[model samples]
Target: MLILYTYSFAHMFKTSSFLMISSTEIGKYIRNMGMVCFVCSLLLIIFPTCGYAAINTSSTLSIGHTLSSPNDFYELGFFSPNNSRNLYVGIWFKNVDPRVAVWVANRDTPVTTSTANLTLRSNGSLILVDGKQDAIWSAGEAFTSNKCHAELLDTGNFVVIDDVSRTNIWQSFENLGNTMLPQSSVAYDIPGGKNRVLTSWKNDTDPSPGEFTLEITPQVPPQGLIRRGSVPYWRGGPWANTRFSGIPGIDASYVSPFTVVQDVEKGTASFSYSQLRNYKLSYVTLTSEGKMKILWSDGKNWTLHFEAPSSSCDLYGACGPFGLCLRTSTPKCVCLKGFVPKFDDEWKKGNWTSGCVRRTQLSCQANSSTKTYGRDTDVFYRMTNVKTPDLHQLVSFMNDKQCYEGCLGNCSCTAFAYISGIGCLVWNGELVDTVQYLTNGEVLSIRLASSELAGSSRTKIVVGITVSLSIFVILVFAAYMFWRYRAKQKEPTLGVVDTSQDAWKNDFAPREISGINFVEMHTIRTATDDFSSSNKLGQGGFGPVYKGKLPDGKEIAVKRLSSSSGQGTEEFRNEITLISKLQHRNLVKLLGCCVKGEEKLLIYEFLENKSLDVFLFDPTLKFEIDWQMRFNIIQGIARGLLYLHRDSRLRVIHRDLKVSNILLDEKMIPKISDFGLARMFQGTHFQDNTRRVVGTLGYMSPEYAWSGVFSEKSDIYSFGVLLLEIISGEKISRFIYGE
Candidate 1:
């Protein structure tokens, strides 16, 4: 028995360690498996998020959920405006501030309770339902589809689709809300007698339809109009050839993206406006106060592009019927030449809403034939620079003369105006909303008895003299402008060096001009491949630098100046003037420049090695530049600065000198660039003071950075920092100075 026990003990001891390791490993594996299974099951049972897409909706979008557009620019969801209790489903800018609703589903019927949802019915109709599944608002249209889906388009349009056929059943654009997005339209359909109008919200917090509505007039050459209930609040005036007569600031010179599609046979018309700026979102919104505004998206907020009723004169009928609103006048309202205020006391009190009445009735449209006995034949009195009256009956007249004759012949016609695009606009009955514009307006002719014209002879004589004097002053100004233009035209835009054989050797009038080559904008565009991403080298405070190959097969670097930068046209001219005269091995060579309107570009010889920072700051590429290479770059930079300070004819102070501004050639030779902020000094001038503290920080001297004073010592201080950065392989900005 002892022998058997000894054998068992020996075997137990040998296998005990193996058994312990196996048990431990097995327990760990089992625990891991259990954890994985538990996690998966929990996910499936508790967090079944397959139905959720950012927010959740398979068939219904419950309250507190949202549907985002593909681009994430817009969102369709539920929210209480101004944090109110009433919840409404609406579309709004996802990232923009002010969070104004662009489109509302249940605007008229608010979901008062929390337990409500926007649901898609089996019949392919969308409905907003309350807690008891009772429909609050229905889309009212159905499509033939077993399964349907809804998608908020990137254009800020919410659409319902037949999933099987991918056919659009309904779109928010079709039934527009207050906001008129790029794709939305103000239209009138003749067949169904249906009209699409933008009805503004009651206020900022309430989605209920307000009194103001924006609609397109269905007449030929359709115009945009804002109505206050059933009455016209403001008219955009008649559509001229390219722009509305009243809003003439946006004319043919400005590229307008407004389209008016009219079908005379079908009696259908649509008015839609869009912004062609890439990725720029803009929408037109009519406010409850009857203000029509075109708001452009600028980052997080909206900038107003245009607003109607901008002034008291822009308010419809501010002076009421037959009275004129003048922007230049003190009291603004005034009666026509042959008319008098209906209420003289009210007129004096600035209450011109009572309008005006003709001094004498038209002989043809008189109450009795005896009214014509003392009066001459009815005549048309001409009024220039006036916003023509509303309620016009379009008549097909060939010319202005024909239009005037037609109006004079009609006993009912009270006023007339001839527009370029829209023929004759003859008004019957009373004239309304006539405005005398200081800048933009059309001519309106009012009908009156010839007796009134005969009575205003003195007034006409005084007006003719005033007009004649004004014309003489305008002619004198025009003559002076023409002479100045002729003098300038004789030379090739001062300091702009023409490369032609007969170039100006010394014709420039600027104080700092020596010579320069003026390149065509077209040539630079072609060389840079229209500034494509592949050709982009780097960007600076001023703007981007592009690598381009010219027609001569010579590689060039184009520095496109930024209009919005702190460095502006002054800096551009300074750079050209200084660099054209500057010639040094260490300085960047300016080949030429091109100025096209707002665009200013400087062309230079392309460096194969790009900038020194590319080698010095890059993680992987920093090692490519060794101690010797870095030392050489430092020496070259020093030489360049020394030339600018002492060696060059004009002592230039490169105010923005830094490592990044140092460009490297194929030989790894450093060259100084970006002379935009450089200042030139004459003899004995050591330093200068400026109110505009400009240039790179950290590299700037303490005195210069703090006191706006700079000198050659400032450049030396920047060089010291740059030298240390090159040696230590660390930016002065990145150093962690600990106490």
Candidate 2:
């Protein structure tokens, strides 16, 4: 409509001019036409969103113009930072308030004029052009004549893509600003010295790099670090299995799951997080005050989830080397047990940066005689509930004992800590950034000279003797009470009516079972530490399984049946009879069974890797098993089923088959277990009917679940469900009908 009006006015003016109109009238008419055209041009530039979101060589995004993300979550064009009038081509959250800019294309080179524009050059480079049309900033890709375009992704990554190849050549994520959105990362290349760090703005109003930076250090078992210029400001500690050792706050309840990807060969590591929930907008920002703050917004306002350098003790090397920082203590910093202040006057003045030095030099450091320089020359003083110090070297050792031995063998080893998920970590140099926690902390053992240990040994001996006597008296009283109670009550035998000794025996005689051994109940009780709760692995339909180690150093899984278990003597007998006869590699080898009165136990070879459900369902562990591993597991399970149904002498039907019942060995070989619900098939038998259903839900066939009609096909149906689970990495119950 505006264009039509302008054209008509131009035509009428030309006609009026030709018809000899008055000079003043012609001038007024020309002024009116110019005002109308200017208004139309301004409207076109202000409202350019006519369902298109792209800019080519011919197009330019001016000061008032904008280019939105495909999902409209982010917008990229021109923005003024804080209170600065200097314009910058940046990306900011569309839904967030106060216009939180995540990425700035020209943070340091801000355009001074409103006529500044963002343009995509024909050479396939995105450039920020000033009023003079001079390029201020460009996406420094090699000049290419190929068709290419720049796009703002919903993930807040601005990318320059090669349209012909549909591949991103450059991205803003690789050059992170102060804020790290979901899927954005802080990457470090140790070998190449290339780092994508989160450097704080000079201040709230400034977008330039500040003194503080958050980056992943290029250390063995790489860790996240916050540095102030060239010095360390805060340390995030080494990455443990699930989280960073120093940051205990990142746990199961955290809003977003933190992930660290490390490539040892490539010498690179990256820290990132996934947006598991949609309502919450989470980002980690490095504040100008040298604090790394993790904040999230839920539509209304931003909430601070966590912040590093949260306490005085969190400051990097707050207590210096060989000094422990305990927030609960009045002074906060103290010298280690075997060490004294290097400079007593400085320490008294609260200047602990001068750390502490060993009071008695290590025997290894002294030129002592060979006999005197033995293991007795030094002892380890155990410090419990403490965060292990920085600059640790990870060593290969099986257990805490081996870790201690390995450290003792090294003369330069200063201290060692054995973490549960992460094994032996030893430090050869000064222990810095040590902090004490109230609970759930690793134990660090500092090596002390024999002279220092001798003073404490006498005290330890006296206390040990006192405690031992007290424990002995208590045990005697407890044993007497147990004996008296047992004497007063009748011993309950197996609930079976038969009272003969043979009643405990199954179809296979003890002598006939060649490989299986009938273990004593006393041994199992000893191995499991008298059924300690700590030793319990998990609970099954029948009973709880406990992890135990035999006297011969063989680990075993003891499945003890509870008195209140749904499966009674029938199931027990069936399991012992069926498993004893089966000898396939994929089948869990039945080491032995114990039938001592009311106590019934099934012993199986302990698989170090535990069950399939553990790795299959765990978010952190699921990546360990790739597609090839899953395929191998599926094939192993199929072979085991084939052996049970067709190959074995006795045809068997496993009524329950699920991820939890599938045990993985040390080598990750799958083994089928839990035969309490298994039934044997007679000759030529194809199917059987029962009034009661006996299998886990979801995996059960429709006919078996509804009508209690089960056969070999029922087991096959369960396998099919298991196969789907292995491929999709989801539980059968979670699978929707249509999906």
Candidate 3:
């Protein structure tokens, strides 16, 4: 019996170790085995993690427990909403800020306790059940789930599909909530003529539907409108030739790839956003304030990429019908040229809700019987830089010319404008919600009375006839006198003079030149804000340069020649005459010139990157000009010289080519500027001489320095010095004479 007891003790010890069972922990190990198997079978219910077993629909998961993906990129289980003890089945970003919740199975109906068991049934449907064994939420089987599997894609879209066919059964995009992810549409597909829309959240915390809705209208030129409680709040304008006119800022700002799908046959449109870069998180959200905004996240909080209702012009009919709104103006609304405020007193008191009325009443259809007396013909007035009115009709089978002709042939056609990229859009009713943009891209023609047209035409005709008669009489008298005095003259004085003689005869006169559109003094003053101190961008010996944006949204740098400045009006005129005709990629475009009321303003394309000196001189900005950009500057100067000296119609010499004269655009493209001291050469001219030894001291060549001789070669020498300066990042003047 003692030997038998010893054998039993050793055997018990060996068995205990194999089962991982100790005297006190035997119960714990047995219980742990059951729990491990339970977790292994339940892995399919929770987000995938390193510790969880690989599971498919065959495995089931329950609440009071969880499962993770193999790579730990996802986790799935029962979750409770904030402040709500009830549990929910949801999927969220495992590694993200704010822990973005992508999909919610039971949002409205939450399970009361931890008794909710989330299971992937054998039939391939995900089922969430309560402790009472009641199905809380189920992936309803509208179609066969014979081979179905649910996958949480890396793009944050939960897609349920048939495993064998790889056919998607249902997607998260079909039932969008508040946030619109990239490639998702906010507008809805109408089912049985009932639209399904992505409504805004009641607040950031609540995902319930809100009061606002966005949809595309079936108007003439179909447009997108946002409504609040069935009242139009914002209109994205009718689609112009290319895009919606109301969203011009989008075209200018966005660099990302995007597309808008419009189906006329299906009568549906969808805006889609995509990115080649994975890190760019793009999304669109309609705010509680009823503003539609497109946003992007960069691993942190969301940034506003584009937003509508951004300006006063975006407000629906803020200026009323027949009224144009200028945000920069005092009252923001003004009656169109031929119209007056309907209520003058109220309009003056900042109340323009009544809008404007025609100054002259329509008389076209007044007397149909009498086509002469009371039957005043209708006429259309040219309105430039005007935004076309809303509520248009799209007419097919008509080009721009045909569209205009169709409108012109009709007596009732009020206004018309053709968009090349979008086709023809016309409005026949009251013009409403019109606003002038700084970058006005539309040209509208408004109808008027024939009497008004005839009155203006008669005055112009009389003035023209009078001027022509005076010129004709003067020519007749000059011909008679020249013919009588030809015998006494050296050559035939009435005919064309030789090129050499013509140059000498007109040397003293302010030469007449063409191709330059002259901006009036008043217009220049308005652009520069009356030479306001605030508009001053920079100052030099020529004058203080002011930055101004024209009515058409083209930014310009105006060089307002100061009275006491060394460069006089004649020098300014010379520069304008020469530079206007010269066009080169490296040369800054001279838009127009103004010489009136003692105000000489030269309008040039604005360069946002500023001059080379602005970047090259300052230590903080100098690093921006790397080897590549500096090399571009060098090559650009070479190409510009090639054009001016050899390629251009007139052989030109830009006598001044300095760092300050080189302007940089927003893209860092170099533009050789400042033709104030420029000289033009005629014929096959290789060289020319100038009496004035004008130019910066350091840039002057030795030959040009001693002698008052200059040519295209002199300009080349200066360009070489500028090239070295750009490379070394040092000004020649500063290098030569210490400052």
Score each candidate by Cα lDDT. Answer: 0.78, 0.80, 0.67
Best by lDDT: 2
Candidate 3 local Cα displacement, residue 493, angstroms = 24
**Per-residue lDDT for 86-169 in model 3, tens only?**
676765545545555445676557787657676665566677789898888876675566756555554555566677888877
Report model 2's TM-score to 2 decimal places.
0.59
Q: Which of the two, 2 or 3, has more lDDT?
A: 2
| Model 2: residue 547 alpha-carbon error in angstroms | 33
**Alpha-carbon runs more than 4 Å astray in model 3:** 1-141, 186-196, 218-221, 248-258, 276-279, 319-323, 329-361, 364-376, 384-387, 396-401, 451-739
Candidate 3, residue 671: lDDT: 81
Q: What would the TM-scores of all predictions be?
A: 0.55, 0.59, 0.56
Q: In candidate 3, where is summed lDDT lowest over 10 consecutive residues? A: 1-10
Those runs of model 2 whose alpha carbons end farther than 4 Å from true positions after fitting are 1-46, 49-52, 251-256, 276-280, 329-331, 366-374, 451-739
Off by over 4 Å in 1: 1-58, 251-254, 276-279, 329-331, 364-378, 456-739
Per-residue lDDT tens digits for candidate 2, residues 1-739, read 0111122333544665667977898799889979998997787555674233666666777777677776678887787778687777888877678678888888778788769877777888878888898889988876665777776777888887888888887788988888899889999887888888999988877787889999987777778899999999998777765567776444211222567888888998899876633344777889889998877777567777778888888888988899999856453789999899999999999898989989988876523444335376888998866777999998989777899987777777888987644678999879999988764356799988987866667888897998899899879966876776666565564233332223466445664453456788889999999989999999998899999999988999999898777987788878887887776668887888887777889999999898898998899999999987898789889988987888665789999999999999986889999999899987788789889788899999999999999989999999999998898888878846774
lDDT of 1 by residue, 539-604 (tens): 888799899999989999999887567788678877888887665668888988877656778899
Which of the two, 1 or 2, has more TM-score? Answer: 2
The root-mean-square deviation over C-alpha atoms between each candidate and the true structure, in angstroms, is 21.4, 15.3, 13.8
